[model samples]
Target chain A: MRISFSTTLMVCLTFVTLGCNDDQASVSLPESAKPLAVDATPYLVTTEPADTTPVGEARESLMDGESATLIGTIGGSSKPFIEGLAAFTIVDQKIPCCAAEEGCPTPWDYCCTQDQVKDNIATIKIVDESGSPVTADARQLFGISELSQVIVSGTAKRDDQGNLTLAASTIYVKP
Target chain B: MLLPWEYGVRNLARRPIHSGLTLFALTTVTLLIFVVVGFIRGLERSLAVSGDPNVMLVYSLTSEENIENSSISAQIPDLLAASLSATVKHFGITHHSPELYLGSRVTTADQSPGLGLVRGVTPTAPLVRRTVRMTEGTWPQPGEVMVGRLAATKLGVPTEVLKIGNQIEMEGQAWQISGTFAAEGASFESEIWCDLSDLQTATKRQDLSLVAMLLKDRTASSEVDLFCMERKDLELRAVRESEYYQTLQQHYRPVRILGWLIVGLVATAGIFAGLNLMYGALAGRIRELAMLQVLGYKRVAILVSVVQEGLVLASAASLIAGTFAVCWINGLTVRFTMGAFALRIDSLAILSGCAVGLLLGILGALPPALKALHASVAINLKAV
Candidate 1:
């Protein structure tokens, strides 16, 4: 009887002590995940991230049916600026040209967005409808700032002026 | 007692071949059960670990077979923002990011072509899969790509081959590597990333694979569910990202059940083999057991001794097989249709092996013990 009691006791203790879960990692959702009132504000929609293309380079490729996220400032005083609610400009990144840093393709010649290069700074316009900028709050559509890190996805089209025009399908203003 | 527990060990030493065979049988059975059950558990765990409860996956109602097959208008996020949740735009804290997925092929540096999954994403893709960290280099550019570390091995190329500055091509277009990312074992590790536009042009696919959304609140999933249910025009579906993998776990139940069946069959065979050995060995010991009974050893005590012997053998086999599983088989990676999962010899598996040993002990000893107990001392004396 003593042996039996001791055996049962040992077995129970072994189970209780060793059976603790090693991977009980509680997968809790983020605090922001708690259900909240869906704020009915003009919002940026997100999808799974796609590849990133510089705003300037995508303008050059103008591949038909091509869409991508353009990562750059939406509106800036340095170069790119919004024309109206429906039209905005993004600055293209400059590549160093032969140590002189002066060699960049003509900004007006790119086929993705309409922009101008002055004093080595390139700026382009993002229009609601390419070559036909309608009246819309471009500032409200894409928050303007040098830090307004914006990402937009769309098809590449060329305006009659041999300028790159991106018909944006999705736009995300950096929060 | 006629034979103390220590004598069980001595008895085993006496019949080397029979005891060796019995031990070997239990070892095989125990190892089989551990591996089969361990594999299922690993798969369930790896999938479950990949999702977050607050994140949601939205795809077209027409989506089936695989995520890459689903296509939606790129403007769906704008539509969802307008109709489903307004809080998404609150405070300029962007929670909605879109993703495009494509099933494409990769040609290795060795010129070997193989299947691969490509995801076109914005910078926010890593933010949604929070564990992901860029281990090297900057984010990708138009002519550049970021490779997931695991994706390298899955693509039949050395992981080092995917380092920054390396080149990989798909759909006749070449992409230079810009960086590598680690996602803490998340499924995102098995994909190659490129700009959404370039992927669309390269593959000629204008539709999206799916969109992952961080909700305004936890309750948004229910709202999203209701929205999907009601919005047939959109032909959309909404589910919590974490719960989606649970559905996948269920979908793979047949594979688990099949493993269990194999374990059950082999374990049963082990039990029968053990029973035969016990019965034969005990038949020869009946006279000795009868003599001990005549000398005042209770039949119950003798029965306990036989069971104890069986338990000891099972315990030994458990130890040997458990060691083998932990040392040799643990951490072995198995690739599934979705991704790879490594087999783990964790606590649960060890406990499972112990339970098998206990059951094996009782079943192996029971019949022979009963036969010994029922034999009369007079019959034994006359027969031998």
Candidate 2:
């Protein structure tokens, strides 16, 4: 009787131990993300900007906060458009995206020209009054898609690495 | 008064065959639970431990979270090392490791070809993958390759075939086995590592899959993220190593759910079996139980004695099963899409098995015991 009682008691203790779970540690998403709202109609213009600099040349010449008009095709990566933001990558017209390459599934990614991509591409982000990138998807706002040619007039935001993000105030979607 | 515990013990001893069968059934059920629980724990641990909070992964954002399919410029690692030199280096050495990761057909001298996860890495890979330790021989030099401890299981080959000095064919090259390594039971243990340049030359691929960096501290993650965001032209995405594996864990939640469902179904079957055995045991003891109740023993006391008999059998069965699982199932290898991981029959698995056995005894015996007691004392005493 004592043996049975002891065995049952041990099993009960085991049950209690089994009920505990080891908590898994996880990293949280960044907290700096903020809401953005912008009206694309006010920023859209029918006239293309004059003396527009090529994306690659503008990248070399543009300084931080300098006003410039840049022209490029709407692609430099597979996912050119950022999710939940009015931003997309544009590559210099000279750099051939994979569109003409044989058996290239993601033509807009410029997979074949990856070596020159870093120097030839730039980001275009539409900004509102406070300068935050618009929260809406760029594809729907611009009424344009990948491979579309367009001109953007904005202040060039250059970081220490010389990578460019054009905070666009005007956009002309070529007919 | 309650029936003496000796009465339950003696009753079990009087019917040795029935009691032995019941014990066998319980052991089988409990052992199955141990195996399933061990599988889930092993997979979860493999992913969880694979991530280091201090390490970060830089890969092409276009790959859509598939690191193997990522293709980035070869110079990205050098660029990152130069850009984040302050927070990314330790002891005058930059902690960046450029790697080429992919799955390829592997062939050992004696075994048929099989698909294996392969990693092309530089010497600095050890800096970021801190959990890895070379267990035998030396690191891969030029034409040689290093295999992780579980590499054999991942490739569906025997352990003897992968020892040092053996040769394995992959990417149209036959490379000598240089050494074996373990990654503290991380998923990396299922991979085969070789020189980055050697793999690139053999496969005719100049691009790299990703770069892994060991940050000086958790705060340095922001610097890496800042680099990726600024250099959006490179189309790179930075993710914490731990967060990457956590995403993989979430991806495999369905498999874990399936594991729990199997446990539930198995436990249910065991309960039914227990119920059948208890019903049989009670049928033969109705008259004996009625006499006990008539002789000043309460119905509740007789019921308690029946439950005691079941609990004793369950406890013994759980003990035997737990020993067997720890001996055989522990560290047993299992293969999946990510790679192979061992079945970890740790303390939790053992306790879960014991709990299942206890449940079998309690849940299986109660219904019939209650039904027997519901009858009046007069009807039970009039039994043939």
Candidate 3:
């Protein structure tokens, strides 16, 4: 079939435009940058798997220093990791960071010398998976800044004054 | 009582130089308007179609302008992403990639300086946004980079120059250029991408500038908004990708308005000049019109013929102007605040120019044509 000059020009232009778009669509991630498969078993925390009626009840059910998987969203900012447990809330015994006037710096920054440093630590109102409130100590464990999905494995402990705290020995992040 | 339009055409033909000059002036005005309007429309189209809607930009509330100024705790992204996944999953959001953007001057091994927008993106970013096309090599490795088409062109860097295994320095840190990409529009066509961690370390930014995520459904803007609002601690605003471009255009409103004002002022002058030209043509042929009047041609008929002459001139001028604009302005690249955009003299732009020309012709011819038609038939006959 014979095509006029203008028709041919238009055809070429259309091809060029489509070709440009197709070329752009093929951008690939570098082989080295591809995400590696993470072990989900290590990060699986079975504590209070189902939604509880209260927030802190999930933590109260755990025995002190007993291994329980804590499933929760990653908090703070940092590199992606499953084991990095920046912070978590236990049941009741929630100490408001404001009461840490005895030189407790914010948990984010540990300034032991400053009387008001402890005031900077975030205080969590511990509640069970059920609607009941429980007592727990707000413990700062691993520091992972970037928010991510995670499951932490740790032992639970209650401090003097009936404040429960989780001493995490091994933490896993669900990939 | 009818006067032939052929007489008006003949009058115009009699003084070819004056007709040519008037037509040229009209053409210039029409061309300028077409080019300016076309460019604005083209830029709007480019920006609207550039990026993916699924990509959300998470910048600091305190930091305005570029994302580079914003800083969050380095762990905030991972934490936020984890906490928000359930809500994001409820809305069917699949890919959430955090990006950190930093502007730095890059240099080749030979010390040639290249200005670039260095973006630190996740591996999944390319999967979410299909517009980013890589022409050669591969995506950036952990410490490697990928350059955009225009950036490569400007820096005179060949695809081969970015060896897959070689490192280049930017801000005293060495990074390898592992790939190259080109996009549909101009903005992304002039940038460079790298690994988020690599750029962060290079810039010494322990915190991410922003996080981008793609929604499984494009219509989930409201859902995303609700999710962000529910988590008052997150403190984010969700905007559609298209709406973001609209907001960007808002930044250029003053310049666009100024451009329109200039075109309007010039067009007004052209209209006046067109009116004078028509008046001169009619006055110079007063005897001819008068003879027609004495021969029983109605005054309205004479007026119609004069107006027809103006239309003919305008039609000719419109064609000339449209042709000039297409040849000179179409696809011509000009720099702007955001970046460079090519002039696009599409059908609408050309039609608007022609419409303006026609309107000018009618308005310019009305008074002169009426005056000629209103002259006394006897006086016209005497003059002839």
Candidate 4:
């Protein structure tokens, strides 16, 4: 009886150990994978087409795989200013840490502040005259910031840079 | 002046083999019960101690998994942090730190891969979690990282390997390792920390995974929960750290129940064996019992003596079992799903186990004792 009772006890303990081992394995993740990101949205557009262009005229031209005029805002940059067109958002930014003696004046030393844009990069997004969205590669595009408004007349096509290319014939900032 | 129990002990010694077997059975059961209870209690205590009441985990309202699948916008963290600080201050809370969490990998200087919970924390995070202590090195600098001891060990790196001057890469960004900390016996011991902004940029995450706050009084946990939930602007849940662990205990309930069920079944088998052993002792000793009755001893005295013998056996078994469990099982550490904890083996668990053994002894001996007491004096004397 004593032996049987002990055997039963050992069996129960073994089960408990197995259960715990399984749970431990499940809670941990793999080493190579990145942790889950909290942000849900992966894409955003900041530009709008020029107001003077005939709305359907750009849409119809792009429907036949032809060039169309488009305009949009420029968002992010590593540097303070750029002369050409690009697509980006105007956000207040700061670096979290700085090398200055009194500390950097920015809210953060590593990144810029949020909701305010300090500089202009000429990154533009082209939209059809009907205001429907068009896909564009952001790296090759140039001048859209929260502060500067621009009008451009160009032939829009998908470029090798992965941005919707508008070969600009006329470009001017809205005053 | 001799006590009845002393006489009973003398009688128990006369039948060494029978008494020893009964004692052994009781001892085995007692030890099992004590060890099992201690294991459960110890794990519960460890869980409670590790969880901080001030911290709240926010998972997706839809799925109960980690926060990765949750889709709250990136801007919500700043907005919620401002609101929580104001609300918590009204209840005497002075600081709140919001953290974004992602699970990431770290490779030591030797290139051994280690898994870590990458937490994106503000500088104020240390203030909110006072239990987290820096064992060596300074706090995290922007673009720099800190790692836990367990993670360090897993990566086969020295604690100083990730110190302030070292640089490590993650998500294509080279971050300097600035500090090391230990949260002793907590899940945090398995994590890595970095500046909130750097982690966000590295992982391309803009939303906060959860927010944790420190309160003025520990007892006001419920109030804080209510306060957070009452706000229409922030849809959130509040649970005390203790209560959260209690809920987590649900995960182990099935195991606990299975343990008890097995114990109960084994105990029943032990009781039956004890009953048979007691019956055998009575049957074989009928001539001795009859002689005692013929020698002018009262039937009740004989019955009392028999019951006393059983109690003596049980008490001896209880002592042996208790001693063995304490020496062998107490403080034994076992790793479980959450983490590792030690077997506590407190006084109460030991006492309860002994009590069960004593009760089984009485139950097994009672029937035979009563039957011997009711035998006719004349018949017993004739048989003798």
Best by lDDT: 2
lDDT of 2 by residue, B1-384 (tens): 778879888988999999999999999999999999999999999999999988889999889888999999999988898888434676778888999999999999796798899999999999889999999999999999999999999988889999999999999999999999999999999999999999999899999999999888775675576567668668789888998998999999999999999999999999999999999888777788888878888878888988988998998989899999999999999888999999988777887788899899888888888888778888987866
Candidates' interface RMSDs, in order?
Answer: 17.3, 5.2, 12.6, 21.4
lDDT of 3 by residue, B161-184 (tens): 555565678867788878778777
Quote the positional error of residue B97 for candidate 4 in Å: 4.5
Chain B TM-score against the true chain B, each candidate: 0.84, 0.98, 0.79, 0.68
Please list the residue runs of candidate 3 whose C-alpha ends up more than 4 Å from where it truly belongs after superposition: A1-175, B64-68, B73-77, B85-94, B103-116, B135-180, B219-227, B230-236, B378-384
Give the lDDT of residue A158 in candidate 2. Answer: 93
**Model 3 docking tier (incorrect/acceptable/medium/high):** incorrect
Question: 3 or 4, which is superior by TM-score?
Answer: 3
Model 2 chain B weakest 10-residue run by lDDT: B218-227
Candidate numbers, best DockQ first, in rank order: 2, 1, 3, 4
Q: Model 2: what is its DockQ?
A: 0.17
Better of 1 and 4 by lDDT: 1
RMSD of 4: 19.9
Report the CAPRI category for model 4. Answer: incorrect
In order, candidate lDDTs are: 0.67, 0.87, 0.59, 0.57
Candidate that scores best on TM-score: 2
Q: Model 1 over residues B271-341: C-alpha lDDT tens digits? A: 88789888988888888778778888898888888888889889898989899988988766666677566
Candidate order by decreasing TM-score: 2, 1, 3, 4
* Reference-based TM-score of each model: 0.65, 0.77, 0.60, 0.51
Better of 2 and 4 by TM-score: 2
Sliding window of 10 residues with minimal summed lDDT for model 1 chain B: B225-234
